[model samples]
Target: MTTPRLTPHAYVLAVPDLTRTTAYFEHVLGFSRLWNDGDNWQALGRDGVRVMLGRCPDAIPPAELGDHSYFAYVEVSDLDGFHAEIAAKGALLGFPPRDQPWGRREMAVATPDGHRMMFANPIRA
Candidate 1:
């Protein structure tokens, strides 16, 4: 018997407003809306990245308000170009792109529902 390879397909996030959050992913992040339950759940994809949004206000605690500790890191081929595109779309950028000590160029932004997303790319030699 041979073992099957494993891969990441999607990540689900609890959001307060499903519709608003879904729209953010679609418009702001350039993700295509793949499917929706018409109420509580929605799935989106961009390039090969997939994300699912669930309507669950109670799942997100109140104390950890605006910009919670949870963050999603996305690897991009062109960090500067990606940053420029999203910034032109009015994205709420946490900071401009900068080279990190770990040899990656990164920029962070927050979604409408307060989910922090970090976009990064390797610093080429």
Candidate 2:
């Protein structure tokens, strides 16, 4: 029998933020600062995956460039506890966490740059 080949990487996101977005990831999400390209680009993460922030032009319009844009998915060991932690930290949560039919419990929050950050956990039997 032959084994099937699989893609190696699953990159999460490359979000855009003008200000305070990097702080939110470091302070709120507990990700460590990797590096910033200075002036316009910043990177942060704990694991191998890193979230890069790119600065938009001074007058660039809104980020309405279809759904192909970046969306961040953050996994938590304890969904309920994580949710509470976010609330306690005064994060502007978009909606309460809810279990989806796809066997995952999740919630979404918007970043300072309008990027959607999703907090999710797999539903166990």
- The prediction achieving the highest lDDT against the true structure is 1
Instruction: Output the lDDT of residue 12, model 1.
Output: 82
Per-residue alpha-carbon lDDT of candidate 1 for residues 18-46, written as tens digits (9 for 90 to 100): 88888888898899989889798999999
Error of 2 at 97 (Å): 1.7
Q: By TM-score, how accurate is candidate 2?
A: 0.71
Off by over 4 Å in 2: 1-17, 59-70
How accurate locally is residue 22 in candidate 2, as Cα lDDT from 0 to 100? 76
Compose the digit string of candidate 2's lDDT tens values, residues 25-66: 677766677777776877777555467767665533334643
Segments of candidate 1 deviating more than 4 angstroms: 1-4, 61-68
lDDT measured at residue 35 in model 2 versus the true structure, 0 to 100: 73
Per-prediction RMSD in angstroms?
2.3, 3.6
Sequence-dependent TM-score of model 1: 0.88
